[model samples]
Target: MNNLTARMRHGVIGVLSVALFTLMSSTAATATDELFGGLTSPHEIDLLSHPEIKQDIQTWRTDAGTQVLFVHSPGLPMFDLVLKIDAGSVRDGDTPGLSALTVSMLNEGTKDYNTDEIAELFERHGAKFSTRYEADSVSVSLRSLSAAEHRIPLVELFAEVVGKPALGATQLQRLKGEMLNQLNDDNNWMPFFLKNELYAQLFRGHPYAQPSGGTPEGIAAVTREALHRFHSQTYTPQNMVISLIGDLALEEAKAIAETVSQALPEGPAQPPIASTPEAEPEVLHFERSNAQTDVMLAFPSVTLDDPDYVAMEIASILLGNHPNARLTNELRHKRGLTYGVVATFMPFKAGGSLQIKWDVEPRYNEASQALVSEMLETFLRNGPTQEELDLARQLFRSEALNSISVNALAVRKISAIGFNGRPLDYIQRQQEEAFALTPEAVRLAVNRNLDLKKSVFISVGPEVPQEPLPELLLITQADE
Candidate 1:
């Protein structure tokens, strides 16, 4: 059931207005920006119900101080609920893996249900729940039918899982053993190693350096007492946001939100992460006997709040992220060096990293490294071509529309945005804003922010000829 059929023709394709940075939109019969509140001009004659799709969102705060965001989706008799808590690795304090260990115990045993009993409850009701922790937040999600008989008991069990847990030393040891085994297994996986090492190197003393999953030493240090205390302090209503989307009336949605929020204990929101210091540029190499070399070039980045964020996102797509972007055209298509290459921009709250990562056969190590550097330099010097910018905008717009194409996606996306303090309509605005992003704007952003001298180069694989890598010319302000 694709619902955006009319919207696609009007709002989605209208992004072609960027036509080589000239506002020549020959495709749209009439612009659909008017559909959005104050976002566009509407013609009185051609009033359409759906120019672009956006979910109807209702928001409020519970007595427990949890932010509740509800989307009244009228379709399947089901609901997707997500609780985004502010207790992640950054809040680990002196104990690095405390958050991960804390969440691992949520369903191990509740006040009335043991691990097996909890699993059976979910299966019997055809409900699902999952817990995940990342650098800045922990998410507990549920998918269950909205029918009163199923939803009522499952919601009760969920409340118990989150609010009343029985922590035991034996359970602690078993979970620790499992985490340690995973760490041991992943030790030799070079890509994982590179990511951990890069963050460690880039933010050595900051909490950002801590891995979301605990290290072996940290996992071992986690005790039953520590888990209990951590849970009490961090998993509280004040620090949480609830996202509920599915078939339900406003009153029913509000009742569910209250139940979930009121079940949590009261506590204050945690403090912000400390200021992240800038990382100095360096060249690093790690030794391993592998068939190919994995290379990464990283430049420090500002947060999403930065004005140039959208432009940089476009630059990442133009550089190597897109299928037919410059790097793929040069390395994979023209030279057949490797099957893939990717450019990633991490938009951390404090600061971030713009990294281009690729693996190439050992024989082409130096050639590939020089080629990557050359391509980056050329992009910084001249910026993305008109076609590249237009294509990137087209792709971005498509992704934004597709974001809410289903219930689960909308629930997760809206929840994340609400938790991160963005407007519910941010996605829709981004889709419309993509059309206004010009190539010159992207060029200025890339030139100002993506300096090679500021990037740290890292390569991991068996040693090859240690040829000095080519030097990149610094793009001057005048270059833009």
Candidate 2:
């Protein structure tokens, strides 16, 4: 490695070691004082002084082709296991929500147990089982005591649920009904409507445009056979990534992985999703009866694996990642056009987007939008000051460390490594990159990635005169 790289790594290690030592000594002292004084309440540790846990991931492939990432967290008597499958909403094909429905039904029932029985079994063993579905992946998480009696049964049960979901006709009907109800309910929420519209406009014909839970009509049309077929195709050993973190030994973790992998059917990974098209710059207004106008300015952005992702991330922080961000400072603090404003980057497996969103009074919609546009133009042209860059770096570093502090979040990071096909040290590399970012790098990233002419502006609120907003390209009434 170069001298600079060596110095950076050494600096990080030195800082972390000193912080850890200080925290341990302080904590011990505080506990002793509390014991003598008879204080029952706990004191908060200084978060800034807390050390970041270095990730030590042990990866290997099971005989059945399932990949495993294991981390031994020795102190805690509890463990977390995450099974991530490539079967997310993007894999739903024409039947939007098929992937989600199939994943949701995993714990509902297996060949040996019904939904209630499954729930009872886990609860009886002091274990928790839950599933999460995202755009590109679906994951099931299990938290259980590390004792063999508790962990073994739960692992076996999880394997059964993943390998052989019943997907009964009645269960399918019930879930479909619930999903439809949710879709209907979301229609009345302005943010939900605006988000869906913005995604649809940005992604257009892409699968990302399809809602993960599907529309009411789509949900109503899902059948038991369809769910079963999707399950058979998507929930396979090769398409899954297993992550285990807890007090278990390496051998024990391997055995658990073997059991789960052997239970799954062998199949190839799902095909890659088609790329999303570049967004066309346009303004769309949806008329609702709401008193406040919800506005979203979005543009296409780099993916997580993109070389420029770190720079884009820093640029986003400078824009509005924090309370003191430019958007909040100008739009809320100075102009008082809105209560708050935020800018964020949403990166998917195949694509991503950057969005600035806020709400304003109906009368201030035009002025607020104009101001936002002007600020964005200026920001892109001049870039952020050194102060902004330093603040963004510090905040990003703190947040990154905090994210992995908890067991659950650390487990999720393992899953992200597998799901995104990123390296085990991805988080560490990201921290290094964020700290190394410069003003010129961020400016280049902003100019290269963000194109105002190719962006989309979407607003949902009460109808207003169009003459005041020359940027308006399309106006339509929101669905009732």
Candidate 3:
């Protein structure tokens, strides 16, 4: 009995020893692998080896107009049309929201269809139509199911909206009243006001400074004659792009495209736009009685055409892009000063702006501005770390891959590529550039673009100091 008991105890001990040994061995192996490889880079990626983008590109020009169709798998029984026009806020003249107003009026009423009939037609076809005005382009889009024969009506409606808008007086008056009410709303934050005011300063005589949605005054000033003239000038087949996607045969799609193109007027005269010029840093300020403080600091940067723009984009991402970005980590996570922050490098036709903006608790308003300013100075003096650049590359690569999967996203990308007058492979080119970015390139971008001293600072909060708000940004004082 004693021998048996001793044997049992020894057997139990042996089992426990083996379990501990296995655990330790597994742990050590994992640690060694992580040491050799990376720990923070969650997924192993080879961005240098470009992924295959299998897109069917079609360029067909009928007697009516040119159509570019990028067809992939018809995953769903739905189709989307991105109707892009060359005219945007850049041609709105002194009327800040004329383009937006014109875009809105299209669906309000048309020649063959009244507003109700148009809405009903879209509803019956199981479709929705929308219009948006960007910096240099305006788009009218339609999304409908293929089973409903949506393409025919969708194209016709688009034609009516673009070619023959019935700018009803009632709709215009209602839209103006709504816009005026919004501008008069005292609860609207003042920093937003300052941002638009900065646009006005930067663009000056350029129409690009006008708000995409015109101000109440601008909307009120728009006459029926002006809408008709603008429509006739801007909405031509020559200056438009019809992007069709989902569940349509190549030939059928081409036929539909031709029909839509033929519906547009020929030889529409393009509106004259002032040449976009370099935007210099300007100091601007506006005060408002809000509990939360908002501050915007903007400086001059590159345009869309510059090769350095890619580097600038990487630098901006490193500055304050994601929720876990450097600025957010330091200011929001560590110091607990502000909850919101963003650093964006925005490029236009001629020049661009690198803007860093933050909203903070009223007490930390001054500290937040000072911290951001100091960080900008430090980043400019010394570029991003190797770790930051790698992270930015990974982030950019991930975003590029994700965007390729969506039809709408692809259309938007193609639109930007079209704006650049580049090949459809611009996204891939951008990805390659991002991945190939060197530390020196990052440093150069920082040095050349970031001007902490020359930023236009606009602080809006209840506790703002009583000071003179300049009409134009004082870049010299900012630089000093």
Candidate 4:
């Protein structure tokens, strides 16, 4: 062997000898007689020791509809109950933000308690009651300690919040005034613009793309009667899931759930979601006078059930997984092109977006676009190398080690199960499936999904140079 090769081999051997000696000496030091046996480091072989999530989740039905029950531990003096109504933004029709306002106003007044009385009830117990809505769900929560004799009263208060929220006209006008004034700021306006433009580009004509927050114009039209109709029709037990945790027995929990369900009217089934276009590529551009350029690039990539979804995730990791990731290296670190860049594969109920977004100096717009294009093109043709794939797997393994908390893992597991409509075993299954993704599988995913020719680019920046700006078809948000 040549001198250099021999020297390299000797260096490796020396390092291994040192590591072995350290391990032996550490083991010897740890071995000692004690009142109790000394322990070795906990077994790394079992990286996942998830809490025993006994999904003895029980269900009961009242004259109203079904109620779901699960045991909870609040570690406090009172019992907390949550009822998640499936009345979401989709039910608001074209009226944006109505669902959010409707939920928030639930605790503002009931037949027995005005807004002040309701707020004071919680303060008396050092607890809280709240209601809010999202695009697909609305949640109501009550918190108190276990030893408190007021568990049943807490249940009744929650029922009142759901059943008889007085949508006072004066209150409606006040909330609308506050929301309208806040929408003109750059941060607030930017988030709305981003969500609306990106989803409209992907899901086009779908209600999912509609604003969940009632628009200023829509909120202006909201009347007390309209909110009443919305409340009576949407909040029902059949469309709801109840979860109670902390200091309640199964029988008591069931009784409380029954009382909450009895308070609501038996509403009609939610209407089917309005049809959305298949996630095809469409270019959307927007203009704003900002100090820094903002950009978002997206393509509809995968659903929760797609077989290649795991490979796509792994590919995303290699593309923008770290400071040394291929995109970061080419676009930011090597070329000093931008502040930072990200590539993410967001798997959702249906197909979702494989999104790459960044902010860069306006002067480098042409170079930034070129670098993104070339990186994607190269990924499509050749994919990641074996060494790159190995490093990515190591990085993902390390991340899993860090994030395996009981609560965090539980949320991840439950969300995956709910979103995919799959069994709870789905998360455990991901560990094996994600690691099994072959390099060729990643290559196929990239080639199939990452189409440079037909993809959307949303840029909110100063003027773009003419050469790069005209290369892609552009539709400004102002027109729509």
lDDT (0 to 1) per candidate = 0.76, 0.80, 0.69, 0.64
**Cα RMSDs, all models:** 9.8, 10.9, 15.7, 13.4
TM-score of every candidate: 0.85, 0.86, 0.81, 0.75
List runs of model 4 lying over 4 Å from the truth. Answer: 1-64, 67-82, 148-150, 186-192, 305-315, 347-351, 385-420, 445-454, 464-480
User: Candidate 3 lDDT, tens digit per residue, 76-193?
Assistant: 5666777788778777887777887788788888878888889899888878788888767899888777653667767777677767778888887776776666555522635447
Q: What is the lDDT for 265 in model 1?
A: 75
Best by TM-score: 2
Clashes of 3: 6
lDDT of 4 by residue, 146-251 (tens): 5535676767777888887898987788877765654444224554577667866776666566555656777777778888988888887676666665456777
- The alpha-carbon lDDT assigned to residue 405 of candidate 4 equals 22
Q: Local error of candidate 3 at 25, Å?
A: 41
Candidate 2, superposed: residue stretches over 4 Å from native? 1-53, 465-480
lDDT of 2 by residue, 1-480 (tens): 434565689999889976865565443343333221322112333323323335778999999888899888664677899999899889887788787788888888888899999999999999989998878899988999989999899999989998888889888888877777777777677667888888898888888888877766667677888888888788889998999887789999999999898888767889888778977888988888888899998999988889999888888888887767888877666556677787888888789999889998877787777878888899888899888988887777666655655457778988889878899878768877776777888888898998888778899888865334334323222210
Number of clashes recorded per candidate: 0, 0, 6, 15
